[model samples]
Target: MDSTRILIGASSAPRDGWLHLDHGATSEVDRRPSTDPSTESVPTGRTQRVEAKGELDRADAASVRVALAEWRRWMAPGGELRFDLPDAGAALAALLDPASSPSACDGAETALRARADGALWTAARIERELESAGFDGSRVRVDGGRLVARAFVATSTSPSNSGMATDPTSSAPDGAARDESNTAPSAASHTAPTVDAPTRVLVWCGGGERERLRDLLATYGRVLTNRSDLELLCVFDGRATTAAAFTEAAGAAFAATLGTAHGLRLGCVALPEDAAGLEALRAAAAIRIAIHDEPLQLACLDLAGHVDPARLARAIGGGITEPANGALDDELVRAASDLHPWFYPVELAGHRVVPGLGSPCTPQYLESRTAHRRQMLVDAVLERVDMRGRRLLDLACNCAYWTSAWARAGASELFGLEGRPEHVAQARLHWSSNDFLPEGAWRFEQGDIANAADWKTIRDHGPFDVTLCAGILYHVRNYEEILRWAVQQTREVLVVDTRVQDGDEVLIDEPGDLRFNAIESTRRKVVPNRARLIAVLEELGLSCEVLDVPFGTALGVDHDDDYAAGRRITIVARKVRSALPSARLGTSSTDLR
Candidate 1:
């Protein structure tokens, strides 16, 4: 009764002030008091706000009815209950929509199959169920392919719910009448949404390193290609040389690599390497790149010099220290000294870990990208294959970000195999730092997926329910062998997220560098087009479909252009009991092009 807010199924990232509870023992909340159903019922009549996201659809009709009754009983007068469920009605409509793309229909079908466990609830049916559970006012509507509902407990001044019936066409709650054509209830009114700020890169050039400057510019050029929103500012020491000298060298490098400095919003300014210069640099960017004779130093700086341990933990894996008198913490600076720049932002300790600057894959951008990918996977594969009590294999799971995500989604057992030992160590560090997963529930092993001997180590883990091959397919030349191994090890579903070409298979050869998180060269890899990738999966006895990217002006996060341009894709392939129909080129039912 002390807490006024309750968030069910908060997964890994539970809010600070809210009372969090999830279904299984994997979450930290499950260890707390009153979490066990056999011990005690949830405290009633005190919570002012309650939210159950993606939880109601996991239970049957009776269980959902009971849960609604319990929620109603637990709410104080005027308390609000908001929840979202997979919208079966929306999926069915999309399936019937002639204008819906083939990928959309495939996604719709996948969603429908996922909710076939008698947990499907349309908007009207959910509103009626809420009214039956003694809610005075309730509103249900579709948002982001889910049935978002809001119900309120009646207060003394509010109308009684005794004989009220919910209108199927109405947007208002019971005992209230509102125009249906008007705007629907604001779903995000209660929560403060995270704003995705633009990514700014501060390039600190110490001078006298032409090759280093060229290399840095080349790296940024590759990372920031097709990304126009990111800003790159090169700050040079005024004492070292004239601003013009630094600008000239940098301009030549930028021109050679990036084609032009103007396209990248690249600029150069002279500043002394003192407190004033640091302040100026701080005002300009969040991520800083220090170019020196030694290896490049990448660190995220807090402009205010505010020392937050959690943020430090997220930025660097560990090394928390207290800064004195609002000064920049020396320990934090030292920790970031050895850190390699991250191409993909990894979520650690509830915040995203973005080690480098101006990659277009900032913490916010990657967070949005991850959410979009997760939603697509849910609609395509996860909705049908429940993660609960299932085993997951993450092949080439760099730092185990997706592995941890599956654990949060209720996968009982997780095994992550990566090519780099450093990444394996990082995966272990992530698991140790986070308390969402129980001990012995997950394991991280270091191995190359391209090695046949490594497959022996992976096979020892046995057949897995779900196999994840994200960010690995386009990096290997022997992709067929990898796919066969994944299919042989997977029992139900295999989710693959990779970069694909448009036409014939293309081979790209790039340097194999640990800094880029590429253990192998692109020369040893083949970037298969979308059609070829699907055909291979279908040949392996799995039905495959390319998941649609949700790209629109309404989305706040800046997604990478590769996704929008169909150069990158996420395909979910499910194992079939019988052989899949031989899908000829351009003739497959799942051809999304």
Candidate 2:
């Protein structure tokens, strides 16, 4: 049997080692014998690969079905098909864009309307058609205003060959021959052939000094030039007293700083103080900011409150720099003062907090503890999970140290729930000073974990991709409830860091507050044995594993003695096989600090 490689809708001259087919009357490949299954009989199960370009969009629904069926029939077991078609959605979007010229808009409209019988060929529609045509799996994505798709024929012999063509002569769309030695393509490569750049939406509220705004814009403009994928949307609060003036000043600042280079990717809007308007803005925004104005900060918070907590994760409270006059108001000054000292020494804007009078531990101790715990979590759990676009929940998030760390690590949305209002304020201050995330992508809420009502509020914000119950489980009297809540809220993984007893018995100490007292009430500490903790987590449908602690000397710094003695352990619990996808359970190693 001859191995066939077919290229349909070839607009150019045919290359060696492949068969080319086209229906165009003036095409160079028109001289070849017709392989149209409808008109002429073609051998089935002989083709190793098939690539079609610009043919599907010109076919009606019935014709598309027939063509797909014929192509799949021709494909051998473990064969593949790749194709590209005009993206109807992209065409429509191009027509809708106000920046598009009249001629360009007309051309897009004409191309879309010219489709066979006014039929539209979208990526999603093509995927469905491919699936119906008996392909084992199919994927479609928009690329340069066109839909590129790949489909595979299923094989029952070996799982390795399930979605890969065996023939060595099979070539990619770019005419490169396939390497027969390579393993099957990864699921991600097939499912998400193209990875679109993540958009960072920046919502700036309240006007600043024109010079200050210009300086800020100048800094951002330089950053934007290098990051074409990042978009900047400056939404000035229309409710502010200086709304019109601020807007005008901002426009001038943008022009002076960025000029025409970033005009297409940057936009400034002044939205009215209506709920509908705010809601619309929130729907499109990934971050929100209020700069140097306490009233504006409060207003931004109020606006953020209306959004679903799960959706409103990232927010910035103030501008990056402190005011020159040094006459900061009460709330701003207090938040900046580190009113509720952070248990972990969180560094923001190149400044690390010094251990103040009420600090529980020395700066060295805090740094060592934070580094050790963070390294353990990353190696045992975080490395396994894809944090790029995942939602994260940080319980008892004092000063949001872990929350801020995860945000920088690439968690798209972050919700840090802490019992202390002062810590929440400090968390806001930390983000404001750093200006690391876009506003509306992170939020620090004050909520008591022990309260069921607070749990209800947290539930509304979930189900989270990852939940961190660090240093709080052992502190709370209701350890079981906390575990259950953490497990219930988490969809993929739950990380617990707590003091564990060496003995089998679960011990409950007398009501006491630790040196780093962030809890509101003096609750008895419930320390469970390692086995009990693992068993409970297993019962909650999680596969739990204790993370290994680095040797005392290997830690590079003096960490707490409890970790070296195995009294304090970090447990990474992932949902059982039945609960999560098998792919997510794959073991991966990450470097330790």
Candidate 3:
């Protein structure tokens, strides 16, 4: 493929798909062409990294291992080798400093750094440069494009249990009554998802100011501390004496000071004329950073082999849901119990425990009740998503669980309009933190789940692409009226997950104070009739496909989940096509009715 430009922060790194790379592997190497200051030099010691893209072929693995081993010897103390080998080329040579000429593509015998840590420093220095230019650090590699080699630095955060990480930031507490056997499980580290590429960040900051940067790093660190593969490194540039130098020294100081304090290897590039000057100090720093902890990147890749990507994607989604709010009331009691606040792993940690869901769950009687509710959520989700790209509206989106999945599936927009103050607040917190999307694009409004008095205010701000109505169908007294109201608000697709049941079941919330009177009859319990939902859609002159999804205690079933023989039924319906397909993603919302 034509070389792709990888964006790393503000910088860029050029990349070519070489024969040796696989997903998730990482490497560090010295790319400087010659150690001879008399010959040529442009920058500091450079390194070439040949990390596996994911898993690699046995041949490529052997070749990389052989090359790195040989490189280690050449880079060792008092070990001096010349750039004469024709096969490996000047890729290694160029990493030391910019090379005299691009090494012949056939591979040339280039001088090698004997120390793996030295290679790490060289790789990290190169990463800083690449990032400063705006390249995705993950894309840095060797044998990219016409070049002999490029270098990179990398790490992973796998929990070590057979690659299953033990989280330091444990799961959100269910508020199970605390007993001797249970203490809040330690939180899990913010590990790269099993199926996803490992995350790497180079914090460039000042040396003494590390205390200032600690909080920023801590936020990410707390989440991933339990991960086995994550490596945090600071890269520092030189410092300035006067505050005025901040304008010039800010970037450098940020790199140098913080990097130095955090024990990050320092890097400064010196010109050949000053080969042994401050420039070498800079180069040496960069080289040291590149080679430090080089093996971890490789370890992460090996661990990557154990995870199934598709499974991880789903699991990560589960990780972001927030805990449900307050004490369970009548209406909520009717809902399943297993309703964990979405994004529980991140949100309800350290403080703010969920009642009855954690270590000391109470009135175990209610636990079984909520267990059914949890199934309702999962079943409802499976149904709503069947219609990808169909616009959706999640009314009363508590933590926007469906909205997220819909968004991922390419739903135009699952406008999560919330009326409940508690749900709205919970949703906002998750969104702002990137625990969910930054703005919760799927979320646009919050107010009475049963009312729309402020809808005009919402429009003044903006409109949604699709609408999702979750956690609201049972609360409203005027179900049909609200259904029409919600449809009128949607532009194209609309998916609503609500309470329903077979004829006259009169499903009462387990707490049994509130009521879902005259419930619409569907195929089964706590679900409204498909025809009733379609009636509203047809009256509005739209076609809808009603698909049933698993729910209730089905969520409680672990592993095969075979125990959830049957319980709740979730129906997903959406507009088939718009009379106007040409409408922009924004302008279409008003057409929902």
Candidate 4:
């Protein structure tokens, strides 16, 4: 990180709110009364020194020290009294002119003694900034009066899902200082944010211009907000900025779309973009998905009409107010869905096929045949599977990521079967390119429910113990015949995973009361079909465990990385009697419902 310093010397009494910045994010100022102790204090003795704390590099801190000292001496009725805060750069140019605000008073001894004790407020600010930068001063000696810090900045060159510096200190007022070295005279009281050179800069811009503003805001707020990662909504303008910002956008969109769009305002911050925004966003870093290249694009949209409950729901639940610029078509948009909700709390090392959950058990989808449904399907399968485990299968696999993982895991066997030969080819290309296919473990074959007879690729493997069949259920036109056929092929476990919707809310308490609503033909879009899927493996005498859970799919809402509001389930059935009439499993398409 480069550092530079700028010093400003002022020789006048500090102006009231003089430190409040007016640089236009073109937004209103944060006039909301601060809850800080300084805000409540009554000014008493004229303080000698001044201090600013936030995530800033070395040059920035030095620059501030020089500026503050010069300002203090210039304002000095007898000595410099006012101080200037530095920007993110020039923190290292701390050489304040000694003549200005020189510690020459007899009272210097007392001030020095008092400073040695450290004021709570100022120390807290410095401490917070240091911690956020991944530096804990607990190990550093405080008497030396230096706040040490460490931090990491993100670097990604992806086209859609791009990122910038993550370190907070690079933009803070100064490098961490024990702060007492520059604390105001102990007897003096402070006021609201010092009305001098602004200690914090809030950069705001609308639409695409948000990217630049975001970096500026990120630099300052990281420490000012006492967070390593600031959740964008922290407003330097307080409420007026966001309120007026959203109000304008809302009125504009509503007036333009009127009632035709059904829902004009799309999405709300759910949480305010205040200090609270910083808190809420910090936890979701793992899955903190950015929909647009610019994080600010969602800023207004998130805070829009959030106060209005009915409006809020309509915006989020309705269709995409504006189609995502398919730029994210590849990145962020995993598999294909906007928000993949595949991660769930299922034991992977030893997961059981729960009864009545629908089709396949614990095994999950790795990649999508289509980028559109990729995230949603990956999210669903991940929800069903545990986080651990190096070995996996991509049965009926489209992308073959499961086989790739097993090969990567150096598994004994990683089998991938796709109904389409082209898909198998694509899967092979991917696994091979990634160097994930092991010498003997990974295998890909072209096999479909209509015709596995000629699908010789899988024949060499023989009757395998475990297999994954996902998305094939609803696509299987011959639902019954396919079920029996799939059963005969499996020796130990047949994972019959598929989509099932509760067509009626009249819950059937008895498992035997289950009935197939309808069967999907060979050529049909299964996503929107208003029918429930039922596994017909019972005739094969397999002990069928039906899981009625519906994971999010192409037909459903974007799945959160955490499984929520999905309708996909997995079924693990054991083949008890392969003796079920083999003639019954022939090519003749049979409808189960």
Top candidate, metric TM-score: 1
Residues 242-320 of candidate 1 have per-residue lDDT tens digits of: 6567766665554433332124555555543455545544444443323221212334433232223223222222211
Which portions of model 4 miss their true places by more than 4 Å? Answer: 1-204, 207-394, 401-411, 419-426, 429-437, 446-449, 452-454, 501-522, 525-535, 548-567, 582-593
Q: Estimate, for each residue in 169-257, the C-alpha lDDT of model 4 and write its tens digit.
A: 22212122112211211111222322221221112323312222332222222222222121222222233345345433333322221
lDDT, candidate 3, 322-397, per-residue tens: 2233222322221222233222222332122122221111112222323444444444545444545555556656
TM-score of 1: 0.42
Instruction: Judging by lDDT against the true structure, name the best candidate.
Output: 1
The segments of candidate 3 whose C-alpha lies over 4 angstroms from its true place after superposition are 1-392, 410-415, 435-444, 452-454, 457-463, 504-531, 548-567, 577-593
Off by over 4 Å in 2: 1-334, 338-340, 504-515, 518-522, 553-561, 577-593
Could you estimate the TM-score for every candidate?
A: 0.42, 0.40, 0.32, 0.33
| Cα lDDT for residue 167, candidate 4 | 25
Please give the CA lDDT of all the candidate structures. Answer: 0.55, 0.54, 0.32, 0.31
Candidate 2: lDDT of 75? Answer: 89
Q: Which ten residues in a row are the worst by lDDT in model 4?
A: 354-363
> Candidate 4's C-alpha lDDT?
0.31
- By lDDT, rank the candidates, best first: 1, 2, 3, 4
Please give the clash total of every predicted structure, in order: 1, 11, 147, 68
